[model samples]
Target: MATNVAMDKKPARQTVPNAIFSLDVVKEKERYDLWRESIACIFEVDGDRALRRTSDFKAHVDANMFGPIMLARTWTQQQDWKRSPSIMARDGMDHYMIQLFEHGQMQWEDGTGLRELPKGGLIVFDLAQAVKTRTNDFCNLSLIIPRTMMDGALKPQFDQHLRVLAKGEPMVKLLRDHMLSLKSVSDRMSVRQAIEVAPATVGLAAACLNAAVDRENPHQGAGIALAQLTVIRRFIEANLSEPALSVDWIARHAGASRTKLYKLFDAFGGVGTYIRDRRLRRALLALVDETAQYRPIYDIALASGYTSDAAFSRAFRAKYGIAPRDIRGNQARLVDIGLPTDDKVDRRYERWLHHLSV
Candidate 1:
């Protein structure tokens, strides 16, 4: 038996300004107050009066600015945190926050009512909206994105605040991995690189949010239809090779009636046509892929749910105006495939949060 070995290389660490604040160095008597005052610009914190007497107050934040985005890690003891209308009005921190708690639990109330985040789930917060949370000892990674940037990636009608994505969701898992990677490699990135990559991070965050939306059962309407359609498209893309892929199968799995499914995909000429087009497009990519150049065309067709070579060729030709073989070795460019800066310590993060729009 032969096995392949994986090669790993350490990232070259670069010197960049990163803000760090910790209660470790602060006197025990002053730790709670310092922690409270430090993040006052964003949230008001209050300790359990009883716990304050017996517990060792602990909290710290290590943060970096990526263009208009901010990423940070915070560890804190049991506390209650709030962001009220007055706080929102005073600081005017109009950003979207995505948080994943690596440890502990939190229960928060917002415009959407009560939402609880158990360990390992991702939670979103809209700074423009008010929220209050009570937490146990926890460590969390936080991403702060300017609303303007996040808005472009999310649907306007989708209520994102207080929405939580379970740790098990595939997209949420990938997003968590991305946030951790960003934190690790950020030091190696230049201000311009950080700025350039901010949008990509925002896009991933939006995907996770939309995936969360799909997991919920929404009422009938254009907004619901659109959200369902997004989920269906992803499903179709993932299962294109299934021989049982059909409108009825999709409708059953997608939890939509045949009429609703058809109506939802009307702009794409109908679900059947859309699926066929996707299969053909996917087949074309396989044919032109350098790594798959040696792959049998028949195999590609079969994998695309085509049992007969002739049928696959005709559909491929009809959609692309050429046979799959024509573009295989030709390597034609397919037009289809849709593919900071901060320093300071002290109240540094609060200052950065306030000026994130800049």
Candidate 2:
């Protein structure tokens, strides 16, 4: 519940430069002129090839391209030459560049290997080493981030793989969707949002790469998967009263397979059983609340996903060893029951009583 501002309020000295621009409204040549000026100023590129331009698709480049953390531009271009190099120099900064190509073909060297990227391929390269890229007609999304970020999050697999196509990976699809969503509002990202999203974006990138390469580290993939599943469970709890809720519906909305979804809730039992227990718990709390005495038992049952009051009462008695009517009648008296004399009482019983007044 703590705000990000409250967590890191030392004020970062504002040393990180901002290099964002838009090319939709400018002339083609003028846009290209501004691109050279902005990139050269930020990266401090002294060579003429550092400012070279290669194609004409009305392309636009707006980026925060320096320091330990930077944003890479996503552009669509068509090249007539057999080999065209966009930028082939070193910035003396130790960072990793990630490229996710959507279409066409390109090749590059990342010090360890010569990576050839086809359509739907992904490439990760080091910035300290000299690299050359050749593309005929390419459209891709690129990310420039600190090497330490990958070192901590990715660990062993960070250096083992240079390029991947990300075939059949759910995390890759999620990263693609998030990047596209961010691109839709590139002009409106606040400085704080951009900073917070940077690490989360890196985490996703690491997850996609690890998933693609079949890495053995379960912690990286499990952490992101659990966080996403927690969000989905919160959504399910918020809409419990709606009769349309089901495993298939929640899985579809969360963009996960039913088997993966079930595995996510393994610590709490399976997804279907979890849903049933949550509903039963809610119904039990309703039964114990003094103000709910006027409500019909059938209404509470329906609200908890039970079609019939008789079936709800059966399951409630099987779990709690008491009828729902008795609990509703003795609601006020049950509060007098003393806290556990030993440490053997069920915790769910305490939780139900705690939320009864809310």
Which of the numbered candidates is closest to the native, going by highest TM-score? Answer: 1
How do all models score by TM-score?
0.58, 0.41
Give the 10-residue window scoring lowest on summed lDDT in candidate 2: 82-91
Q: How accurate is candidate 1 locally (lDDT)?
A: 0.75
Give a tens-digit lDDT track for model 2, residues 278-351.
Answer: 67667876776568778888899888878887888998777566777777655443433211112222222222
Candidate 2 wrong stretches, greater than 4 Å: 1-59, 64-68, 76-90, 108-116, 157-161, 215-358
- Regions more than 4 Å wrong, model 1: 1-14, 109-115, 215-345
lDDT (0-100) at residue 200 of candidate 2? 81
Lowest summed lDDT over 10 consecutive residues: which window, candidate 1? 335-344
Cα RMSD, each candidate: 19.5, 24.5
Model 1, range 77-184, lDDT digits (tens) per residue? 888998875555345456789999888889976446777885688888877666789999998999998876765577656656677788898999999999999999
